[model samples]
Target chain A: MKGSGGARRAPRSTPRPRGRPPGRSSRDGVIAGRDALLAAAERAIARDGPRVTLDAIAAEAGVTKPILYRGVGDRDALVFALAERLTRRMTDQVAEQVARTEDPEDMLRRLVRGYLELAAAQRNLYLFVTAGGVGDKRLQQSLLLADGAAQQFVDGIAAFRSARGADPAVATVWSYGLVGSLHYVTLWWLREPSLELETVTEHITSLLWTGLRLEEPVD
Target chain B: MKGSGGARRAPRSTPRPRGRPPGRSSRDGVIAGRDALLAAAERAIARDGPRVTLDAIAAEAGVTKPILYRGVGDRDALVFALAERLTRRMTDQVAEQVARTEDPEDMLRRLVRGYLELAAAQRNLYLFVTAGGVGDKRLQQSLLLADGAAQQFVDGIAAFRSARGADPAVATVWSYGLVGSLHYVTLWWLREPSLELETVTEHITSLLWTGLRLEEPVD
Candidate 1:
């Protein structure tokens, strides 16, 4: 996550429930029932793969199958719903980090560390969002929004550079490169959960602050 | 890839079709049949999604479904076979690029362009490899080997900086960052097939070469 100077929320997702609709309910019933079903969907998905059936979630939610039907849509919709919730959480987390620091570079580093920690801790949600990277437009859009937010943080850096009258072209490339490098670190951190988040963050920040281009050693 | 850093013939993949069983000729019936199936896997995967069935693959191979059983084991085995072939091809491409260049930076840039091109051309394989990014040790090992090979070109940059006696520690991070930056750009290129691969390459290389790090812009 890069806290670009500006970031909007990721698109929402919904996981539909399966079953005949339960009888009509009051506004309170609708809210409570939907919440229960969604919670159940998350738990089932966490334990099993995303293919968890609606029956399992309905049972886990302590609601009748019809009640779930009244609350959520089909399995895919339910998955979508859960994904929407998680994606928003990540966006908010990134936004919150922005509020904490005005330094663009520090904000970017902190956002990367923050998201990597979340990815490490919530492996299931990480998989849910990333699994559909290329296949799903919704997933891609969600990520793009996140990236856009990240770019905003990098934009802040570029703005500072432009003010100093440094090469605007170089600043643009460096900002994109910074976002790209951080995404890789986040991917690695998600896959290798054992690696400490802060360590990887520090490693990335150090490198982005310097250039690796140099001459070969002569024998 | 990366010439296995001298670990030649190192097979990270499992359940691949063996060359021969005693008395079996190079073009034995079983071997030829398996090759046909493997090639069909490529075509079918290209035409369809990753979840295409073995029956479909065998049918695509123009042989009865039972013949596939003689070569690839179960669904997992079929997937493994397809992934193995793709991995080898990608690795070879990178190795060829790495060997062709003399300048360390050029080697890294060429490697990036090579990978980005491959990812664009082979959508199925790209998605399959990325899908295996988390929780799949075998795939991770294979990819790391592939990435490690890519990393070697960047490591050349690190080696150069080391020779200059300039922040050796920072050099390694910068090398990794450059590799990562290019890698993420490939992901973005997937969406817009017309994305200028060369433009991105030039943008990234310029940043690395120019030694510019942007600061926070306060309006």
Candidate 2:
């Protein structure tokens, strides 16, 4: 229902039929199959938390583990796919909010607040994709999300700095710092739910907006 | 030799002899055993990278896996112990640097530069202790290091704000933001080794010092 006409025409029950002929329509079917597996994976994570196994995800999809893996590769690949999905959604939401606001301060507050809200809403899935593994794969998955988010900011930041007659090279470092700070703050807030969302947002916005030094510069 | 007299007298090779008499000296023996195991873990991680197994670590310590487990608990516990050890050394270095500098800017630069240098020096161990695992244990372990670093900054930031007649409440959030930013920046730099340490430290310092807005405030 959500995809193109070709996808809609494909049978939902059997997205990829065995011994299917290779064609444009079949390619769409493959896409649909992968999407279905991802959707099932999200559901499984939501239901069973971060420890949800691939078997459980396959069961949720009404398919075998081989089918699930065939559709989405392995567990790490699935996590990367989920991370891509989540970060895309987050990026879209923040971009929408940024588009509506011209004020830099308001833009930052909206960005921070929107990020926290989305992360909190998808708390289980966020944990599932971001913190569910160890080693290089986990670090790569997290960096993928953070780097994607930072990429979205780089252009905007560069433009803003150029307009102000400042070096735009700082955009890369600043964007990474901002995104990383927000990422960790979200993790801390998720763990300590007692902290008010507004408090966290305002504090972050203030720190970024005015810098850490509250006193007037002697120079 | 590093510890008190009781620890010095304890046999380093056979730290905990089986059927040892129960006394204050034996308690010292237990402490020495744990330290020896931790040292072995550091050596193993340094040699084999983050994926170094408990068996490898035990072999490095010249003990069996059971002895290693008894001394350091499990893999997670060993990781935690290593994290604590690394963070303590980092904290001590930062504190020493802070003590030597009166200029706040210099202090911050020293902190950031020192952190990067230390992390680069022990890159394998850093990866081992920080990114070796996934799930709640990984998060908890990372948080332990971040929180410890943030704790060191809380008082300093609070006092700085108080002296300027600003509310000190922002200290907690600011400290976390600063530490988390540094943590991620270190991770990024570690991955992208082309970035110079001085360059990264300067950019972070400038970001924290002057913030994102490079122009004069309209207000």
Candidate 3:
């Protein structure tokens, strides 16, 4: 209630011209430049945290703060824009990586692993998007991004299990369970940098592949 | 790094003296009164959000700010103490609920639902414990409360899972995955009030119960 829910999107790699009504003639340059600025902003955030400032982002983009301000309004706007783009890019990257795989299990595992890796490589960005605060608009958009990813991952789990006649319930639990666990892994990973990503992946995979309590087959 | 894990504890009904610690004798009259004040403060946070002021907390306790401050410290300490007590009550309550049942599946579902309900009831307390400013020592204690709850839940899941001869990798995945999903559920429930607790239980259970992707059976 305190902030905009879904109304405003933070500016991102996908750009919009400054406050011009839609379909304005001088939009393309504005869009491209905006995209560059957002990308630059994201890089800056990666180097710092959400505290990355307008001056820094502008510097990274090789543009003046005035130009950046005109493009995105303010610091919060810049973060919103950058986070949205980062989410989109990460989503697309995961999708593209899994495109060639036919097995849903393979796809899902790959997705989890890919996400974890990206989180490690871009720890700052991942932390910003997940735990960092912006306006409510950014929070809403980021929540949407998270929800969308969960849905896709859940679907993949269900379809894969059903394909092999595995208990559908088991599949449902397994997939979403993995989704739940990975979020924490990202969180913990940030705190304990030395924790091996490979080990994290291995341990999580072990849980999903096996389970918590060691029950054997009825046979 | 932030926020309490979900669930709200009901206000304790007992009365006690003000200004005296639990063991420090001689001032017994003030002990129950102070207890009453802290309990009332808990209720205030549970009803109001974390931003509810000391004046409000004290008023809710049927006393003045100085008396309340005498019991605790400053405002941050007041909020933290409330959060800690709330967490303590929640932990006890949850332990009681989960203890009655041996079935991991049932335990997890009920746990998720119960915690969500607690959080919804005490929005301010939940935010203070989970995502409030870090400088407050109370915030740190709250994190421990959350970590303890999460560890207990995860251990339950892990135990039930490993018993069935599920892959160790799978169990780990499920543990992290469920935690992540539940974290979001509390926030989502807040945003979408129409979402029934039963529905959330079913949906979350279904998502995790089904597992991750559309692929071959491991066996």
Each prediction's TM-score versus the true structure: 0.68, 0.82, 0.66
Predicted candidate 3 versus true structure: per-residue lDDT over B43-135, tens digit per residue: 886677555667888888866776787888776566566666776777777778878787776776777777777877766666655544322
Candidate 2 chain A weakest ten by summed lDDT: A1-10
Which lDDT tens digits does candidate 1 get at residues B1-219? 112346467667778676534564545445446777788877887776544556777778876565677777655466566666765676689779778878766866677677777777887655544543223332233234234544555555656656555543344445446655655555555754453778766766655554345334445
* Candidate with more favorable, higher lDDT: 1 or 3: 3
How accurately is candidate 3 docked according to DockQ? 0.18
**Clash total of candidate 2:** 3
Q: Which one is best on TM-score?
A: 2
lDDT of 2 by residue, A1-219 (tens): 122335446546777568635546544545448889999999998998777889999999987787887898878899899999998999998889877988877888898899999989988898877776556556566676668876566556556656554444466677767877777777777887766899999988887777776574333
Could you say which candidate leads in DockQ? Answer: 2
Lowest lDDT block of 10, candidate 3 chain A: A133-142
* Per-residue lDDT of model 2, residues B100-124, tens digit only: 9877778888888888899999988
TM-score of 3: 0.66
Reference-based TM-score, model 1: 0.68
How does each model score on lDDT?
0.59, 0.76, 0.60
Candidate scoring better on TM-score of 1 and 3: 1
Better of 1 and 2 by lDDT: 2
